[model samples]
Target: MRLHILGICGTFMGGVAALARELGDVVEGSDANVYPPMSTQLEALGISLKQDYRAEHLQPAPDLVVVGNAMVRGNPAVEYMLDRQLRYISGPQWLGEKLLADREVLAVAGTHGKTTTTSLLAHLLESAGLAPGFLVGGVPGNFGVSARLGQGRHFVIEADEYDTAFFDKRSKFVHYRPRIAILNNLEYDHADIFPDVAAIQRQFHHLVRTVPGNGRLIVNAHDAYLAEVLAMGCWTPVETFGIGQGDWRATLVEADGSVFTVHRGDELIGEVSWPLLGNHSVMNALAALAAAVAAGADPRVLLPAFATFESVKRRMEVVGEIGGVRVYDDFAHHPTAIAATLAGLRAKVGKARILVALEPRSNSMRLGAHAQALAPSLADADAVIFLHRPELPWDARHVTDALNGRGTTAASVDALIASLRDQAQAGDHVVFMSNGGFEGAPRRFVDALRP
Candidate 1:
């Protein structure tokens, strides 16, 4: 089968393209901005990629078009597909019909930590010799690739809550129908598609409704929004995990937040000593462990794998160090994510100066929906810098004003880099936070910091 994917450079779409190729299909794809690691990974897989979406790019007429969620009505390829009445399907729908339909799908869903938790679960399964297939949003350092077609009965996926396609308003996870679903946590995000938290909750409820009565739903016990979602309806047996509560819980064993002791109710399961920093990571570990156990892996044996679990890329990833100054990259755009990333870094570095560079690139941030919460989220950072882009809907001046001298705003990437070079001292840890590449500012800062 010849499949042409639109907006295929995105993490999820790129993974789909790779999986299609792995499944013995000839794959070609087009996207507006084709940069990598995703582009590089696709090339490594021998997949052909075209730069921007053009109607002519579809001249060969693929047997099927896999549309990405990023694509909309105005995309030339989408319009061409519609005009020609060509057969097309959303990426998630394609994966559901082709890959997930027959497998025991272990899906990780939440506004945050989906990628990390999914990768961790996949790794645990692999450690248990399950060799499960997986499609994660970010590249797990352990896996090397973001997507794989393993020969196991289980398929682990980073189930996103984003809308499937322009034609499909339902969340992407709705198509998954996971046998083992992990609702990591619930929070307001993606302001572009969702009107508010309640609207997002409705979509999550849709996901909960799909789980089979025999399957398991692993959730965060402390999240009130998740409670509300479950109240809407849940047919599956549920297992909860939190810091000090839930059927599964993690007790912090170390002050630096690196070591944790896992417990099943009052019974001690085991301890996990890893370099992972923050309570969020601990919760992610707990969630992953619960889902793995639900998938039939013995909890007692899988606990030690957590110690060797490498984190996903761009989640507090230390890119390089120069002049004793460390530069890190994180895919944190929302207030909650930002807070977690910084708090984790704080726990790891202690009293060291932590400088945060943020680009409000996500749709919610661009619209200034979480503007009021932005400043407080960066409270842990010793100094905060906002990369201001005029093309976005909201003004960065408002964010700077909210910081009240605690933060500074930069109109361009160069300005931001210069500010960091001047303000960042030898003992400082500078973290670049954005969903997008932030105009390559993170790598640029690492290079600039070199002697």
Candidate 2:
């Protein structure tokens, strides 16, 4: 089959392209924004890529077009495809109907932690000799690739709650009928499509309804929003996980979340001493462990896998460290995620100065939905340089003013990197936070700091 994908550079859509190519199909794609590591990964697969969605790129009309959620009706390729009456399907729908029909799907869903949790779960199942097929939003350091068709029955996926496509308004996860689902945590996000927290919760409930009675639900005990989702109605047997409470629990062995001991309802499973940091990381560990056991792996056997677990790329990835200064590239745009990541880093660095270079790249951030909470979330940072581009609709002054002299605004990525270089000194941790590529600012700053 010959397939042309719209918006194929996105992490999720790119994974779909990879899977299609691996299935022996001729794959080609176009996108407005093309940056690494997704772009680099696609090129390595020998798949043809176009810079933007031009009508000509769809020439001769492929056998099928996989439409990404990012593609709207007004896009040139979309308009051309519709005018020609070409056969098309949303990415999620195609994935659900094609590859996932026969696999034992183990899906990880939430507002945050989906990528990391999914990667970890696949790693655990792989270590247990399951050799599970998997698709992650970001490349897992353990596997070096985002999606693969493995030789085992289990297929682990990072199930996102975003809309499927311009034509399909329902959340994407509803199409994935997983036997094992993890409700890691829930919060109000994606301000572009969702009106409020209640609206988002309704979509989560739809996903819950799809799980069979024989399947298992691994939920977060601390999130009331998720509890409400379950309360709406649950048919599957549910197991909860938290730091101190739940069917599965963890006791912190170190303050930075790097070391922890696992417990499964009064029986000590084992200790986890890994490189991850933050209480959120511990919560992710517990959730993955429970889901792995539900998939028939022994809990005790999976403990050692945690110690050797290599996390997903760009989730606190260290790009460079030079002249006693460490630079990190992190994908944290939401307020809750930003706070959790900073808190973990603070615990790890002790009293070292933590400087943040932030870009409000997500739709929620650009629309000013999270502006009020931004200041308080950055409480862990000693100073912050916020990128306030001219095209952004919202003013960032409200957030900067709330920082009380700790925050300032930058007009561009170059200016932001320059500001950080002048302010940073020896023994400081510099973090660049954004969901998008931020024009490669993180590495640019590292280069500027070089001798």
Candidate 3:
């Protein structure tokens, strides 16, 4: 089959492209801005990529067009496809119809931690000799590639709650009817698409409705929102995990927050001492462990995999260090995510100054929907620098004003870099938070910090 994908540069769409290529389909794609590492990954697969969306790019008229959520009604390529009456489908639908139909799908879904949790579960299944196929948003350090077609019957996927496509307003996860579903946590996000927390909860309920009666729903025991989501309706067998509650739980072991003990209903399972930092990560591990168990793997036997598990790239990924100052990159744009990331870093570097370089890049953040909550979220950080781009809808001054005295807004990437270079001390951990590249500011900071 010859397939053409729109918005192939996106993580999910790129993964679809790669998976299709691996399945022996001729794949080609186009996007507005194509850069590493998805671009490089696609190139390595010998898939041709076009720069921008144009009708001419569809000259060959492949057998099918996989539309990404990024495409809108007026996109040139989309309009062309519609005008020509060519067959098309959303990425999730195509994936469901193609890859997940026969496999036992283990899906990880939440407002945050989906990528990491999915990657961890896939790694656990791999270690257990399941060799599960997976399609994660971020590249797991354990596996060099983000998407793979494994030889096993299990398929682990990072199920996002975002809309499927322009034509389809429903959440993407509804298309993936997984046998095992992990609800990490729920919070209000994607302000552009969702009106409020309840709206997102409704979508989550829709996801729950898709699970078969014999399947399992592994959820965070302490999350009030997730509880509410489950209260709506759930048919699948459910298991919960948290710090101190649920059928499964984890107890912090060491002061540095790198070690912890796992428990299942008061029975000590095992101790896990990993390099992953923060309580959120521990919760992610618990969710992954529970999901793996639901998939027929033993937590006691797979405990060693948790200890050696390498985290997903860009999730507190340390880029470099200069004069003892460490620079980290994270894909945290939402207020809840920012808080979790900062808290995790604080747990690891107690008493050490933690500086944050933040970009309000996501559509929700750009709309200022999360502006009021932003300052309180960064309260754990010693200091913060905000990257203010003019294109964003909200005013950066409003965010700075909310911070009282702990925050300063930089109008440009260069200004943000200079501010970091001057304020960051030897013991400071400079963390850059954004879903996008932040104009390559993370690397620029590391480069400037280099001697």
Top-TM-score structure, candidate number: 2
- The candidate with the higher lDDT, 1 or 3, is 3
RMSD of each: 1.0, 0.7, 1.1
Most accurate candidate by lDDT? 2
Score candidate 3 by lDDT. 0.92
TM-score for each predicted model, relative to the true structure: 0.98, 0.99, 0.98
Per-residue lDDT value at 80 in model 2: 98
Q: What is the lDDT of residue 181 in candidate 1?
A: 95
Question: Residue-wise lDDT of candidate 3 within 292-410, one digit each (tens)?
Answer: 99999989999999878998889999999889999999999998889988887887788999999999888899889899899899988888899887777778778777777888989
The pairs that clash in candidate 3 are: none
lDDT of each: 0.91, 0.95, 0.92
Cα lDDT tens digits, model 1, 230-345, are: 99988999999999999998889886569989899889998888878889889999999999988889998897888788999999899989999999999988998899878888
lDDT: worst 10-residue window of model 1: 389-398
TM-score of 2: 0.99
